[model samples]
Target: MCFRIVIFVLFSISASMAQEPQEYLDFILPLIKEAGKELLTADNYQVEHKKEVYDLVTIYDRRIEDILINKIKKKYPNHKFIGEEESEINGISNLTDTPTWIIDPIDGTSNFVRQIPFAAISVGLVINKEQTMGVVYNPFLNECFTAIKGEGAYLNGNKIKTNGQTDINKTCFTYELSLARNEKYGDMYMYRLKHLTRVIPGIRSYGSATISLCYVAAGRIDAYQCDGLYPWDAAAGVLIVREAGGYVCDSNGGEFNLMDPNYLATSTKKLSDEIMAIERIADEERIRDAKAKTEG
Candidate 1:
């Protein structure tokens, strides 16, 4: 009957959609491990500056990105790729609805260049502009953080969840100042930091957005905030946080989008609200200061 055919077609579409993330996971997990090994062993890789003196890129970053892009293109020729190095080279600015891989071959290039061991290779898959799979591997720590949409997040194959800490005063949080990249924004972040330090038990910056988000998912840090992040810097970590029962959004509490450059991630919605409240205050003060300067 026609009705039976319609039901079968709908079920088939639903089933295929459900299976896609897992299929991508199966393809990416081993690639992540292999890339992690290369990152850990590459000692002679060249380092370079990009855009600013503080923004760094290394030969390993390019090499790993090349490896991943090639393999992915070969396997899924129709899929798109948005890699940090490639974007830097080609000036790719738009993210399409076509299935895409957003990659940060080495997230903490400064740390990696200094042999600080806090770097990670972060990869995130987006299908129809929605994040579906994420893998962040820290070679030095041998930690692999992964998430599949609708499934729970995992660290080293063990299921992980956020700390569930709601009290701002009792919680420890991370704020990545390096990503501010602009003096005014950095000043605003410092202003927030001063307020946070007065109340929170502890504050830290791991200098790696991917690791900071993974730590939040693992319950190691209660929240993290940063601005001026690229899609690759945030795509994987945001999905992992959500899968681990955490919250991620823009600075003003809007729904997170990869194209948006700001992020506030927290272990719980309550914690996120509290942090964003402080950020709002700081932002207001920054706006007031700028207005005063313009008036004067």
Candidate 2:
């Protein structure tokens, strides 16, 4: 009986210690720093159009991604990867229970190309299909935000927290509305933008979703709403916001998914609920507008 109890206890302890987010965070710090240094020194970076004329990828994107994936693979041969460039060719990797590393080498490729300092090399670690840790590094701006599942979020080695502003009338917000330039997504984003504009003082659009989320995590912004984001784009930033004591949820006020994280992240749940209400109103208005147009 004593032997059996001891064995069970050891097994439980091992299971609990199986996947450590801090361990993963430690491993990634040097890698992102290395990538950052290269980015800062890089000039004459080659660029190519992805899906749209404005959607661009630079040579640094691939090079930095390869470095992260290769280094991580060397350490954890069994780990999986879902990277921006790699997904463009092989498609997104399956999100299984196995440990996976999500990588976005240059989240703001356009910003990087345009010499904007908002670009970041973002990464997230998922264990058992749940985001357990994340890191977002903007080298040009010298900001690195990090977080683990239970541990608090941090920026530049200092602990961080959301501002926790609850008033709907006093919210500062950001989103990606450039997708509206494409006809297929225009109404979907424009309607929400119109409603949001009426309530908020002025809207800010950072071409980089990673930066937007990081800024929210650091309490630099009160709320951020984004849609049509890939896993890598939001995976790291979402975890950072959540760990910073912010609320991250689906745009429809549903449970947020790390795999498809088209989310509304806010400093507080009350703020999230308020923004969600505005979004609901925007949706209804959009439906009415579409119906009227068709009837006309």
Cα-based lDDT for every prediction: 0.89, 0.88
lDDT of 2: 0.88
TM-score of each: 0.93, 0.94
Q: Model 1 — which ten-residue stretch has the worst lDDT?
A: 178-187
N/CA/C clash count, model 2? 0
lDDT by residue (197-291, candidate 2, tens digit) is 88887578898999999888898889998777889988889999999999999989999987777789999999999888888899999999899
| RMSD to native, candidate 2 | 2.0
Best prediction by lDDT: 1
